[model samples]
Target: MSNQEENINLPLVHKGKVRNVYDFNGNYLIVASDRISAFDWVIPTLIPNKGKVLHKLSMFWFDFVKDIVPNHIITGNFEEFPAELKKYEYLRDRSMIVKKANRVDIECIIRGYLAGSGWKEYQKSKTVCGIKLPDGLQESSKLPQPIFTPSSKEENGKHDENISFEETVKRTGKDTAEKLQELSISLYKKVADYALTKGIILADTKLEFGFYDGHLILIDEIFTPDSSRFWEVEKYAQGVSQDSLDKQYVRDYLEKIKWDKSSPAPELPKDIVEKTLEKYTDAYEKLTGRKF
Candidate 1:
């Protein structure tokens, strides 16, 4: 459903691909459902506990990275939630009550490797998002240094176009743009290094930020299976796709299908869904050092 249509019943604020956000007076309640998407489209089946898993993962990261950057989470107290959602107490870990703010209109992306859309751009013009890369870089190859790649935060169903840092400055003002880039790179480096010690490689990730009284705070989800590419450190090899604990199974299944990616998405088989769930669980366990 379109975001506006989905907002009609509840005090819905924003509905993204996998989560439904609701506004209750001054506080906001973000609900993570069982929704699963492939190739930017929501598939029919649901992954059990997928919402809770993502919520817990983000909560864990927010705590881990809080020392480096502040977040917008207010509370996840189930007992204090409004009576309207009393039945969903089980989802306490899957949702959060946060102080909503004016979220910036740019997606702060940090890339430490050449892959995905970045790889495609490099193939065409030896650049990704208007930033030129060095010569002789292979697919999935690590760059000499991580770079901050910013993009316009398009609405749901629209594409997010990558733009240069100067363009980002034009849109978000010079100071805000500079601050987002600095914080993005810092958070990515710290988290990536921590993940390395745990045997997982954070290939690249995107972060969403919002402003509360002129202070930039990390909002939305952070470093989950959906937001970041998590690969096995031992399988790290340049010039090829690495085995991942993220959405590799889903992408592989989609590749096997004969359906054109442009058209409506094809349905995934049960085995594919089950395997994807396992990967998500594995990633959570590895990152948090706790069983999902």
Candidate 2:
């Protein structure tokens, strides 16, 4: 269901491209919708079971990394949710009760491999987010080391532009900026390593952090196909774009059709929607070792 169609009784707080946030008492109820977006547009079609895949994968990763950083999740367990929430059986496995936080307005991006906007930046200035890289890096070449590149977090329907670390310090305080970098890189390395063991390469991922109760904690989604680039290890090639277990498949289709970004987004074909859900479920199964 689309965010606009969600029928939760709580006061609507924010409706993102693929999720709806509702004010639940003083906390928040975050529901993952089946809506899929590409090129900053929320596609009109819904992918079946897409929301459950994102929510379940996030629940697994949140538990896996809780030792490194606390998250906004209060409980993913439906049984533990408030009695009022239990009435919405459709929310099962697709929603979470979370702490409301003062979210930091930076997209904490860690790139282990050169691709996407980072590659476009490297082709011209040999830098990403103003971080210089080694000479002669190909389109999808593995970087010598992962780097923390941050961007300004824009509101929904706007594009997020890459920013320099200095700009990050300017926007946030120096101490907060440094801590964000440290935590972002650490989290990326740990999860990337774990993904490698599962035969998937976590090319790059954007993380969101927020201040909750005077402590910085992870917020939003983590390592899910929507938030991260996942490539099959066996299919990876340096000089070309690798097949991804993410929405990149849908993005490629949109690009192939040459959909003018200014126009109303096109509805995805049935095969495309099915394949997209397959990719998301594939990532979830491979990373978490659970059938989807």
Candidate 3:
């Protein structure tokens, strides 16, 4: 076997939001760091164990719902991780060992509520990514059923644009497009239903999929606060926007800034950083029913 054939800690190919993807022989070792990003730019501060919490939460869902669908999780145990990462075992729950697959070029989005780009698209065109909604739907109103809205996975610093299903088929092949849509909606509904029962309203989420061999598998994080909009069940109601358990506070702060929302992201204030960390911790405890 070549040196690269044996599991070795190599260089990283991509870093996004809270995770770092490093080359580990033929497989990849994805390390979940405590880093956070808002408005598509990575912020300055770390959120103590945020990566581990996110990883643990996703692992819980993967196990809870794997019977419903297959995923790409190779291993989450530190003992099985590459030797170079053993010192970071304190964050074992956040990192994952996964086969590096050819990631689908589209971002598979599922929306159960009208907000974010969905809301903005609806307000202007009375539709979101080519899916028209019923008239008179208020902000944050729940849809009768979840919808699969695909977006472009742009290069760094570029915004992901919501594309029609036909457009998705154009970018990815027709067969792959059909599979992604089916799998995305299936997983979203299963995970969302479970979260609802656990007092967390999974308003909406984004999932990325990839092809490993001939199988369609779920890649990246599932329904973590960073990837999904989570709300407290007791406070959620139709028509009214409730406080999100995720990084809404951080987003709100960023919105108030004068930056152009581009590269070289602004440094978040200490107080804002602290509050954001607390929010992540609170969501970890609330959704997982355990302390971080």
Top candidate on lDDT is 2
| Highest TM-score model number | 2
lDDT of 3: 0.79
Q: Which regions of candidate 2 deviate over 4 angstroms?
A: 1-5
- Please provide, for model 2 over 70-156, each residue's C-alpha lDDT reduced to its tens digit, 9 standing for 90 to 100: 999999999998889998887899999999999999999999999998999999999987889999999999999999999898995
Better of 1 and 2 by lDDT: 2
lDDT of 3 by residue, 1-292 (tens): 1222124345777866677787776788777777788877777776666787788888877787687667788998887766677755453676788888889889999999998778888889889888988998877888879999999999866877889999998998899899888888888888878777778888898889888888877888888888889888888876766688787777877777866776577777879777776777777777678867
Q: Give candidate 1 misplaced runs (Cα > 4 Å).
A: 1-9, 77-84
Candidate 1 local accuracy as lDDT? 0.84
TM-score of 2: 0.97
Clashes within 3 Å, all models in order = 0, 0, 0
- Local accuracy of candidate 1 as per-residue lDDT tens digits, 27-137: 788878777776677777777778878998998999999987789888766766767766655546777888887899999999988878899889899998888789899
